[model samples]
Target: MSEPTAFLLAMLAIYTLPWLLWRAAGQRSWLPLVVVQIVGGVLAGPAVLGAVFPDAHGALFTPGVLGALGGIASWAVMLFVFVAGLELDLPDAWANRRDTATTAGLALIVPLLIGAATAALVMRDSVWMGVGAARWQFLLGVGLACAVTALPILLLFLERLGILRSPLGQRILRYASLDDLIVWALLAVILVDAEMLGRQAEFATLFALATIAARRLFARANERDRIPLALMWLLVVALGADWAGLHYMVGAFLAGSVLDSDWFGIPVIDEWRDRILTLLMPVFFLSTGLRTRWEMGGMDVIGVALALLAAIVVGKRFGVLLAARILGWAKGEARLIGWLLQTKALIMIIFANIMLDRGVISPTAFTALLLAAVLSTMLAMPMAQRAIAARDADKG
Candidate 1:
């Protein structure tokens, strides 16, 4: 078949296979569509499909097809992350700065320390460090991956639990929003190039000026004009960030953060975000699957993932509980807060993808981190339900 036709078929299969599997299995409660999509991506990767049917894998995902898919995936993730930036209510976070800081700091720092320790151990095996990574870069990347709370995924889980706009829910959102900023800042630190420091500084200045201009324009724009202008702005900032040695994802987040969500209308932004996820993000998931590697062996990858999972669960809970103690929150608050913040599927996956791209982590390490994210996300709702239920029971 022709390349274009083959590419179309691949894309169709990429989108279809997950839905088919999700439905055929009776739409199992444990496996949400998002989880299914992620698993589908891994199953579609070289480690599985390529291993089982080399010729077919090669024929379907030729260089040209992969290249085209890469473009789609890039745009998809940028738009998704950009929407995340728009959703962040920094003012809310600022208003509750002390609580936000106490919780976010403990929640972030404890996992980072534990994760860094895990990275140190893993690096001794000398297999998971990326080719381009310095000792410090690999450690920090892994640490941050461990600490990440996938804000987008957390929102979905909260919505599922029927507490998305509740007082407790808003508190969690503020904590996650603060951590999201820290996540990207850490990413910038890890990605900074000594040689390009001057260039990066220049880019930051230019970006700041441009952000001011964009905010002015967006404020005056009517609802109809904001979106096209936003898209134009997204592309331009993303390009500039890429040129400056910061990743486009970083640029995308900055692009959205400076503008007021009120300017575009929350409902409109929500609709656009949902539409983007539906139409484009599956492509990104598939492309991500294509990048998974198992050179260190599948069982070994699973072992490392399990280890990381233990550290993440323990460190996150410990940190959160410590913070709760200091704040004198209600008895059951910390457990619920910890599990809710542990959601880490999409954003963590994106973070790992960037690390992998930059060679800060080996593909095997990336796979391990990816598995941990999926498993952590899967555990979030089930564990949280039980936790919240117990808390209510105790209160009653």
Candidate 2:
């Protein structure tokens, strides 16, 4: 209750909270850690605790720390995308063309329809005017975010049910891989266009296109024999984005899609994933946990919460399911598409942090989105696990 005591407790939080998140993330589920951080931060600081003495404590996500965390997260993204590139079946590409087309269509079109409708009808008032998302662009961001399911999560879910190599599972994975790759392309073009039109950053899009061409040229010159140097080339693109005032993630994503073509072999990507996933990504996650704040953000932003849920659960998953059905998939395959496609993690938190920091959405909206994302991941995964398990059991 005393000023000095509250200050000490606040200081303790910065260190203690991250440690707990670090531990929670080690158990292979960092989603809950995001929730804990937000709750813990509010409990320790001025929003709740410092009400008695307004200036007694501190803020949770300071700008300097956020920037550092952003840099760290960019690395996690690079590692994540690199692995995504490897998961694609380059040799069997022709065999899965129908599967990829169906999955990509369902993933984007269905949820986009749901999100646009939801925004116009359900969240019409915009709760706090400037405090929440505005413009059709923001809605498009919501739709794109929902439409593109994380192939990584789908892969993990399939493996858990021991269906990674199953016929149906592999087909679904191929579609997921293709869709994810295409999603990155869509996202890159969006970001590039956003900068061009919104900010009138006249040189941004052209420079980005040039970077892609240049990286490719360099990559080709040395070929696969120069992966180490190519990685250095990739890092240049990443850091160059930071220096250029564009988000580094856009660069990393573009690189991944371009690299997703199986530049050399799967072994290279497999090794990269093993090192990055098992180590660096967790630290990046814990850092995100440390930044999330729940106190200032309340249930007032229910629209944002509902929007996140609709996108992840319906748009992303159901889209994949629709694709499979259109391709003459059986009921079980369709269900698996729906189930596996909904497993979202990592990127949800990452983008939540981005939108929040950029003022695209309020802290309240950010907070609500994070919570909804946490709940979405928790709810979807168990259902997916059971469905995949039951499907496999039936096969036996």
Candidate 3:
């Protein structure tokens, strides 16, 4: 078959198959569409579909076709990350700094330390660490992966639960927002390339100046013009970051962080984010699946993934419970918040992808992280619902 024909077929499958499976599963809240899409990507990837039907997988995912799909996936994820940065409500976080800082700090730090310890144990086998990674790099990368909360997915869950505008929901958002900023900052630190320090320094200097000017320009531009201008800014910053040896997604997040979400209007931003999720993100998920490898043995990868999941669950719950005790929150608040914060779908996957790109984690490690992320996310809604039900029962 022609490359174009194959690419078109791949696109069709990517868009349709996941939704079909999601519907077939009766659209359970715990098993969200995004989680299904991710799992679909994995099943269709080399570790499953390719292993089962190598000829068909090879024919459909040709080099030319995969390359074409990859370009779309990269842009899709960059836009998603850029929107995530733009949506951060740092001002609110600052306004509620005492509570937000305490919760977010402990929430992030505990999991990070636990995950790093897990990484240390896992790394003893050597197969889990990337070829070029220092021990510190692998440890920090995995630790951050465990600590991340997917802000976008968290928003979706909040809205679904009908508490998006409630005090509790807002508090959760503030905590997640603060943690998101710190996690990304640490990722930047991990990605610092010694060999390209000079170029990175130059990029940083230029970025700072450009951000000042761009914010001013954005302040003056009307809504219609702001859309294109934002995309232009995203492209330029992403390019510069990649050229400077930091990943483009890092640049993408930075591009959006400096601008105010009010500039684009909240409704417009919401619509854009929804549209991107509906139309473009599936390709990115598929691309992620294509990168999965089971070279460490399937059972071994599953074992490590389960271990990471346990660490995340125990560490996050302990940290948040500790904070709740300190702040004198009502009983059960910590458990509810902790489960909600465990939504690590896209953000953690993106983190692992960056590590894989920089060779800080081996493909086997990446696969483990991916599995852990999906499992953790799948648990969030159901677990949160149970928490809420239990809380209501106590109140009644």
RMSD (Å) of each candidate, 1 decimal: 1.3, 5.5, 0.9
TM-score of each: 0.97, 0.73, 0.98
lDDT of 3 by residue, 294-394 (tens): 95656889989998998888878888998999999997899999999999999999999999999999999999999999999999999999999999898
Candidate 1 residue runs with Cα over 4 Å from true position: none
Give the count of colliding residue pairs in each prediction: 0, 1, 0
Best by TM-score: 3
Ranking by lDDT: 3, 1, 2
Q: Quote the lDDT for 234 in model 3.
A: 99
Clash pairs detected, candidate 2: 106-319
lDDT (Cα, tens digit) per residue for candidate 1, span 98-181: 999999999999998998898787556668988967999999899999998988778777888888899989999899888888
User: Which scores better on lDDT, 1 or 3?
Assistant: 3
Residue 18 displacement (Å), model 1: 0.6
TM-score for candidate 2: 0.73
Whole-model Cα lDDT of every candidate shown, in order? 0.88, 0.58, 0.93
Q: Which scores higher on TM-score, 1 or 2?
A: 1
Task: Show the lowest summed lDDT stretch of 10 residues, model 2.
Answer: 125-134
